[model samples]
Target: MTLADHHHDTSPSRPTGLGALGRPAEVRTHPLDMTSTAEVDAVRTALADAGLLGETVRFAFFAPEEPPKSDVLAAAPVDRRFRAVLLDLATGRSTDNVVSATSGDVVSTRELDPATEGQPPIIDAEFELIEDILNVDAGWLAALAARGIEPASVRAVPLSAGVYDYPGEVGRRIVRAFGFQQDHERDHPWAHPIDGLVAYVDLTARTVDRVIDAGITPVPTASGNFDDPAYVGPDRETLKPIEITQPEGPSFTVEGNHLTWQNWDLRFGFNEREGLTLHQIGFDGRPIVYRASIAEMVVPYADPAPVRFWQNYFDCGEYMFARYANSLKLGCDCLGEIHYADAVLADDLGNPVTISNAICMHEEDFGVLWKHADMFAGSAETRRQRRMVISFFTTIGNYDYGFYWYLYLDGSIELEAKLTGVVFTAAADSEYATQVAPGVMAPYHQHLFSARLDMTVDGVGNAVEEVEAERIPMGPGNEYGNAFRQKRTRLTSESQAQRSADGSVSRAWHIVNPSVQNSLGGTVGYALLPEGQATLLADDASSIHDRATFATRHLWVTRYDPAERYPAGDFVNQNPGGAGLPAWVAADRPLDGEDVVVWHTFGTTHFPRPEDWPVMPVEHTGFRLKPVGFFDRNPTLDVPPSRGGHCS
Candidate 1:
């Protein structure tokens, strides 16, 4: 039944029986909320006692939806449960054991597909081992000495998902070492590269594979003058922090995994692959999104040279997205009264490792939301825009990507990613370099990211409708036809939903529940608005093309499946081709009036400019899913006005 049809009141303060009559006014804690520290420890202890917590038999959090649908979760009894994914490293067999956190018992067990075992995340042990090799290994030390570099001057960071074409044993992690210059106390490491030399470490073998120097002349070290007080430019002075005070209290409240802001509510969680996930979202107690996450991202380098061609990487599938999370500093990554959420990741040995301040939640001023000046009335009305920002940053090799999910008072949601940090460079002659550096060529590349949005609309089973604004033909009506019309088409199946952005025309797709209707008799839905998109430029027959078939389409709609979390398949490193989005959608399942997951691909084609040298500024790109006919009118019309004085 539609929310409006049910005349029942569902406010949290007053209990109301629910069974399609209406849902709860307040949000409930999602079963998929991030596992807590005690829960992690308890599960670890249980597995340890059962002799399942070892290097070979490891335990990981298994994300699963509760038996009952999200719409009925409020009426259902509280059943706090967790599942532990047992992965056998030797045989690669996986099992799912449902762990009752409340009862502290393994309630049920089931076997999972062998391919369901997620790739081991890059852990502290891997980094520590590489550091030990650089310091203790005689050969590595000799190579550094030969380059006239001291151990203290060189800083090594893990370069994950490095191209590995070696004929090696199975289940070995090949980590590439990227060294940085650490000359001064205040110098940032990325400002200098020792040049040419790279160390390959075999984590499984616990040995340095080989140190090879590419045949290229070493370029001069870039300036680390960012910290130098004398090297100041216009607008270089640091600005003072503008504090946002809450005289009473915040307009939001967090209860366990559920957060309620104004009229919006959502449940958030963190996973190793997807990083931050928002589940069971609602506005005014009406279901909007069932689940949403940054599913997978592929960064492919355009250079065709031997070493560079294979440098293409699927960051999410290869290296765990959450393991590389940047522990955000209070005044740096976020501002104002910030709420921090820590993420717990399993180590190589399956122990729970907590990364503090991995996700930051805060509110920000988003400029003017709405303004009108009625000269006839001799007055103006304006409502200042403010948005809640949920953000996390991950440092993958030379690049730091800030992933932000913003919720606006206007019932709009935005997913934005900012790419900042040093560029992965190669030595080149001054003639070949035009944009990034004189002697160093910052290789042409594209960062393609896919956001997996599982929309439930009012509840489950939503349909996708593509709407395009087209100009009306002049001859059709035999009159002055300087007008446009909207062409709406419903994508009824999976194959029909796989679409590309037709940028020439104004178009948008919506996830709508056919049963729900707005006050104007329009289908209630959220519009998928793609901003910037960069398709894969690699040859269709290329290896990189096969690795990431999800990039071929701008949007992919598929039937919801818990196992199909990743776009580029489970294992992307050194993988010729296996299972991915194309293979998963080969079933051609029906999508209309079914649980659907929408994959939105947005990216940037980075042709590095000269200013990108040293450290590149943050390049922003992403998409938004805004409310269309979901509401009766402007959702922000009732927002309170700012009481602060305006500057003349």
Candidate 2:
């Protein structure tokens, strides 16, 4: 049933929900929202008492329970359960478990398969142990000594271990390590990249498996310092401070996980797996997206050098995307009246670790939404545009990514990924890279992100169609031919839905409700407008191509399954070929008017320029979701004109 027609009952959810990480004094726990810190503690205690959690068990992911869409939409009495992916450090076995927060009873438990499925994410403790493992390795020390670098003078940066010709590490947990010549404590380690050295550190054994030294490349001596006044000179004094004040407070209200602004209502959630997700996104009490999030993201470096050839990092699946979220500050990170939600996630030891002020929510003004000047009537009408922004920033290795989800007044949704950070550099020069600094080359790479939209257009019955603008043939029995029409091909199956974006044709995918019709008798739908860029650039035979099959296309639609969450399978660490999206679509399930989930791959193909040296400028890549026949008219027509927002 459509929210507009079904009394649009929220759980009294006009306010935003609080996350489980931790909470302020004013915030209260919402059961259907994110898991509470108390819930985490209680669940962990229950598992340990029940012998489900041993000392060797580490938590790869722990967060609030996701109630079935049926129970949620049907408004069933949902139980409070927390889901977890616990890893046995001794045997490297990943177990998926569900425990009730109230009764402390195990709801379900199953051991996962790393060969057929995927490996669990690399826990934080493994990353913390890289330097220790590297320091004790004689092979790694010999390689560093070959480059005239000592153990104390260099830093070992932990990196994602990509799949390659490593038979010894088939079933073991491993993390790649790169050497950086660090001259001092304050000196930037990224500036002095000691190229030709690699360490395959096994986390299970707590030792460096082996070292791959291609050859000694000259280590760059130049400094890439952005903080020091000596290198950066002085702060810009010419710029004026821009202060934003909400005189009457923000338009959005947050009560626990629920967020409501104007006619839009939704609940926000955070976890150690996929950072921020919106649940039950409804506009004007009409359901649009039941859940939405960046399921997985892959950063494939194009450098083919032997030392760096296998450098594709699955940031979410392998690195734990939410674990490294930046604690946002008030003035620097955000402006205006902001409501911050903390994300309490389990650490490696299954203990609650709080990331305070991780999620930032605020409102912004965007020029004009609608304007018309009827000169015949000698009058004009214009209305301002505003959006509620829910965002979080994650600092992963050499890069920091800002995931921002904006809900506009025009009933449009946008997910913009703000990329700004230090580029990964190497000492050797290569054609597949850009020389950002003297003797240092930054590899040309692409950041491909996949957004999984588990859509509930009106209810559960939804369909997708690929719409393209096409020009009619001039020979179509016309003396003067200037006609063009839209070609909308309904996607009926998973194989047919594996599509790409074509900007030349102005292509877009619309998710429509086959059962719901608008006032014009057209189907009520939402359009996925892509900011089309190059997809995966690697050859079809490449390792990353097979592992990251989802990045090879623009759109993939599959019948909704509760277990099919991650795009590139669950365990991304050392994932083999044909495990994720490609494997899931082997059945080619029917998508015509079924419970379908849309996976949209969009990204930025970055070729670093000289200006992108130390700290790169923010590069943006995203897609927009706009209403199509979902409303009777301009929904913003009732929006009041901004007070004194125009000239006389």
Candidate 3:
């Protein structure tokens, strides 16, 4: 019988509702929610009316602060307010802090003030201007001709040329060109190479600063090797679309910016800073995490040569991830019945611009969640696993990072970061570029990213516990030395919480609410289960190390402070280093049974390989926040088996 044929049977495995069981009374549009296109345009008009428009002044979102956000979520009446950062780009730039603006009327007027130079949002217009310049570069065409390559055969991609402080330059629109081959009219232009040719353009001077043309290296060509037909397995050439059918329709509901799926509920919003943020996260109508987002990321290059020493990149702080958001396509980046979300941004003229399909939410069949077969009972039981995925992707220059938040059937939450796209390669000297190529070295680098998790486990008074499996001596209790004991240690303060991942022991950290207990007398909590290679390998004294001290350890718990958002202070591009996580944690604040924030750092050290040339395959790293004693029993045990029957 088909899966749907057995729907009439009232089996234990059959799910009742295809959508939310109940709606939360307090659930509504978040005030800190991303500024709408209409609101953005209105704000722009208001700023102009106030004489705040100039070439030297730029706009950032006026988001709601923590107090207002908390008040609104608590169902308490709050005045509608918004905050934004205005960057002063004038020469000399004597200002010590970022220009701040607040608006009581989101549509009309705003009050401006200067405050502690917090993390600044990137200039969106600059990237648009770069794209315009590269599309019509005569100099680039001539350079390609000089190298005996036709213009049509090459595809030039504009990359943000990092600031190195050249002699006497202002309003400088710096961009470098990386060319790809378009042999055989294929869409995979990343197959070929343009060697190492650099170009600098000044918008103010309206001139090309310099064109450094290096020696020509053999073009790395790829036409048939990586395409669909050849890349497929033997005898696997049919291109039929695999469909995911939800017989009862989707188990989710989206009303405005808020979404409810099964036992989980959350609000999603976008901004020109951190891209996507999940707010007011709840499970089974109870609050869990107040807010969760990717706070900041730093990708530091190891080569210290003059040409590459200053290659450290603070992606979230410097360029801002929102500017690089990719408009994902269906059946490519995601599958199933996809629900798309659009984002509104400002154009070069401070007008509203809409990016469609910027975010996608869908349900995925996550294989088998739980199964048990007993020969004595002559019975087999299993339930198909399912998960809800909320994802958005951003392509920052040469690399692409996909941010995903998953809600599992068993009350577990996972945050995943997927790294893909082309590697940042440089022209190498006669010294070997290793096995990849003769004159190209994909410099070794580390990508360290941290997520700000404001967790409220059954209200705000929560404590952290570090539990480890320790091996004891044989003399203890006159027992065998083979036995390992469970050691539970309470992290009473921030100083004790700032620690590294001890791989030698089987350990876990839990954010627990002592006031809430399960039937077993265990505290209600969620455990932080760290995964992947998360520690930063850089030296302690380096600039990268100093700025990203948050990366030194796998996890850190601190008392919640609104100002302490980003771990790598705000001005990360060529920063002097003395802000972000290290500065915040240096105070050693109390963390027990108070509103606390958890910072998780994870990453990888990439050493480029030959196959990694052109475009590298995607590599992933992430962690999970699983329910520990939060539930009285195994929640998934009651999940009904699939009507399609068991797989034997």
Runs of candidate 1 with Cα error greater than 4 angstroms are 1-30, 55-119, 131-172, 176-189, 194-201, 207-213, 228-241, 349-351, 375-379, 430-438, 476-481, 644-648
The residue pairs in collision within model 3 are 13-640, 13-641, 62-83, 62-84, 119-570, 569-580
Which candidate wins on TM-score? 2
Reference-based lDDT, each prediction: 0.70, 0.84, 0.66
Give the TM-score of each candidate: 0.82, 0.93, 0.80
Question: What ranking emerges by lDDT with the best candidate at the front?
Answer: 2, 1, 3
Residue lDDT tens for model 2, 255-298: 88899999899999988678999999998888999999999999
Compared with the true structure, model 3 gives a TM-score of 0.80
lDDT of 3 by residue, 546-583 (tens): 66678788888888887777787755543446668778
TM-score of candidate 1 relative to the true fold: 0.82
lDDT of 1 by residue, 355-446 (tens): 67888888877889888888798767888898888888887666778899988898888989999877766664433233354455677888
Candidate 1 weakest ten by summed lDDT: 1-10
lDDT of 1 at 235: 66
RMSD of candidate 3 to the truth, in angstroms, is 9.4
Candidates ranked by TM-score, best first?
A: 2, 1, 3
**Candidate 1: clashing pairs of residues:** 435-610
